[model samples]
Target chain A: MMHHHLILRVVTKMLVGTIILFAFYVQFHGDFSPGGGFQAGVIMAVAFILYGIVFGLNKAEEVFPPWLVHKLAAFGVLVYAGTGVVSLLLGYNFLDYNAFNPGHPSHGQHWGIFAVELGVGITVTGVMVAIYYAFAGRPPPINDEDW
Target chain B: MVETIINIILFTMLVLTALAIVRIDSLFAAVMLSGVFSLLSALLFVTLDAVDVAFTEAAVGAGISTVLMLMTIALTSRTQKKATRSGMVPFVVVAVTGGALFYGTLDMPNLGDPNAPAQLHVAPEYLAGSIKDIDVPNVVTSVLASYRGYDTLGETAVVFTAGIGVLLLLSGLGRRRRKDEEGDA
Candidate 1:
């Protein structure tokens, strides 16, 4: 009787898709809008959290496996930090996008930011999914015997 | 005059909500009130034109954090023991520390001043040229991912840590089928 309600599942799935699309818009349009990596990341995570709540932890894991999430989250940060390290190796200040290109600093900055935002989005979504799985799979109370 | 009245009302509500958090005996009610407090604070941030901060506060503080806290409380305890004064020294120290932090805020830039040091520095450069330079419409994204990518990388690392921590904590306990069968046996 305490299982996830059908309405909750339907509503949450709809909301999750909407939130993901919104996050995509925000991330891509962040160069001119109020949205940024942090906001987009939070919104992206929210979708996974909603899904976990509505569909159950096992189902959530099936969609975003814990192992895959772990690796993807780590890879995301690595992609971001690796960009900076590459710049440093190229003989510029760490994270200096200018070093990413031999010319046109503006283009370099654009490319760098885009890559980093993608990384942020990936890490955010993955970790949020992981958190949902963690909290969801927590052992329920030993009182289910009454059912 | 209306703006002044609105500010006054907002301030009063903030204070009353803080008091409500302390006064509420029910843990669930306190958690709900805390979410309201976060939403109000996010609104205050928006009024200050710190839209980015407002968005984050709304999503994290009011949304995810509240739900997480409620889930934790459900998994843990519904009723809390009455507070005792026998070991209140830490509370006093933390209160004093927090008060000191609040006092330090007096030195911060006046709210919404476009000429504030924060706005005049790298932020302005980013705001003015990010679109032309980055080919993106949202400057916040450009700054976060490109101009200040190192910091974003660190934030992602923090997220990675959280994920790992969750996996480590929950892995063994998740063998629920085996546990259930063993329990039944």
Candidate 2:
């Protein structure tokens, strides 16, 4: 649908890689920085959404299928809850990180935080992309000239 | 002093953008202006030392939402219907709410007051305990993930549920429904 927009396509192709790289940075380095899973996930979703906009929704869906996106959205929640369940099984309070590393509780905290943040990131990315797909797949009621 | 000046500039821009959004009849133009409004709010958040919030606002508010709204505009009407009724009711409600909010602020602490009740409350202990327990350089992460992990878990579930809800409502484009309808027919 956006085939004639060569400039947008070229610019998006260039920016997508950098956007993905920055999203990863925001995701992993969040513990020491301002960003975390939520912001990183949105940023990550932006990369794919931009690609979908410049190219076409079908190509974007092919790269990341809608079924996979739905599964991912749920899987992220499982990853988050599973961490707490692990702590519970290990004889610590739910979500208590001390269960991970007996000798160093702080390291345990780090691991637990990382796991949950990853879960949050995955879920957010899935949801955002899925919404984008749903919206873009629909037939437009009017032409560009209507606006 | 410099921060205050920057804030004033951002706030002015924000008001101007909001006024434009309200007055504009073209939904597309309104959507674009709202994106600018979000960007300005993100900048204001930065001045307030809330970079994490600013980041989210910039990404979700300015970037993702703009795309989403544009898609919505495509699916719906391009121009908004003019309101047939007078705007007096909404104006009175807004004025009353704003006045009440201004009154409520009179009892609140000033910006960054050292002796504010919130500063003396659990915030101190949370800060101290976070350093000793979590040892994460970013206290916000530790607080959200470790200290208030249950809340974070709940929030994730909410996000998950929201995605499910949207899928249920807007997945009309999906072929599964059509195939099911055909089979039933």
Candidate 3:
């Protein structure tokens, strides 16, 4: 596998960085654009998946260990639920952003949306990469030439 | 006139791609064609002024799903098996389902009708109030992340559950257990 095509490796190296940068741009600029947490997360995962394909699953796992990925998935849900719980404790309805800033409700709404979207982005990136790992980690039943 | 031409061309391509997918026995070609189908629909969505939906369809449908399908093919088989019997029963079932769906669409409101029930309902308030309440330029973002936060949270949970299910099914838990037992011995 290490002796695989150099051109593929070089192209993947150049593309991976650009892909991750675009993912972040999509994640943050989503407030003003067509993308959001879901699109950004998938793009982020694609970076890792492409790396896994070109380098090898073991090398990709070294960069983003599986245990960390699992924890990140759970952590995203916790972050989202925690935002709602905070608003509830502040004497507002569940997920009421105004509770965060009583003097300036719209500001609070902005902050709340940002937090929740960030949580969504993290969870999506985690789950996508996890699924890819699950599929690619398996030993292929047939040889490559068989395809 | 331009919009109509674009719509017709995109839909024509979509139908042709779908037919090609059906005709091909090679699963790899089918997967690639399905990605093309997704891209065509994304273009259609863009023409309808639904940029967000188009972005999602292109990313998920054309990008990730294609990769996933390719991985699945690697795990399974490249070619589809030939049917041993006539396709009459499946054809009848598909025809009946398609007819029922088409019949259901007859009651749908016409596209872009301002007075349609869907447009008249919560949409008006969302459009009017989003800027004042959320101060966000993108109403869709404000609605998804702020006003309808609970629904988005539910969707995230659903994604989480699906990931856990796949991990349990395909992560080779039994193989790890056997390795642990061997170390103990």
What are the Cα lDDT values of the candidates? 0.76, 0.90, 0.91
**Per-residue error at B124 for model 3, in Å?**
0.5
Across residues A3-102, which tens digit of lDDT does each residue of candidate 2 receive?
Answer: 6778888899999999999999999999899999999999999999988877889989998899998889989999999999999999999999989997
After superposing candidate 3 on the true structure, give the runs of residues whose Cα lies further than 4 Å from its correct spot.
Answer: A145-147
From the highest TM-score down, the ranking of the candidates is 3, 2, 1
Query: Which candidate should be chosen as best, given DockQ against the real structure?
Result: 2
Off by over 4 Å in 1: A1-4, A86-93, A99-102, A142-147, B86-95, B102-109, B112-139, B170-185
lDDT of 1 by residue, B33-133 (tens): 99999998988887776787888889889988888777777677765788776658987998999999999999998877788998888888887777676
Of 1 and 3, the candidate ranking higher by lDDT: 3
Question: How good is the docking of model 1, by CAPRI class?
Answer: medium
Which whole-number lDDT from 0 to 100 does residue B95 have in model 1? 96
Query: What lDDT does model 1 reach?
Result: 0.76
Q: Candidate 1, B27: how far from true, in Å?
A: 2.1
Candidate 2 stretches greater than 4 Å from native: A144-147, B173-185
Better of 1 and 3 by DockQ: 3
Q: How well is each residue in A56-106 modelled by candidate 3, as lDDT tens digits?
A: 899999999999998998888889999999999999999999999999999
- Tens digits of lDDT, candidate 1, A45-92: 787777776666677678778888777777778777887888889999
Tally clashing residue pairs in candidate 2. 0
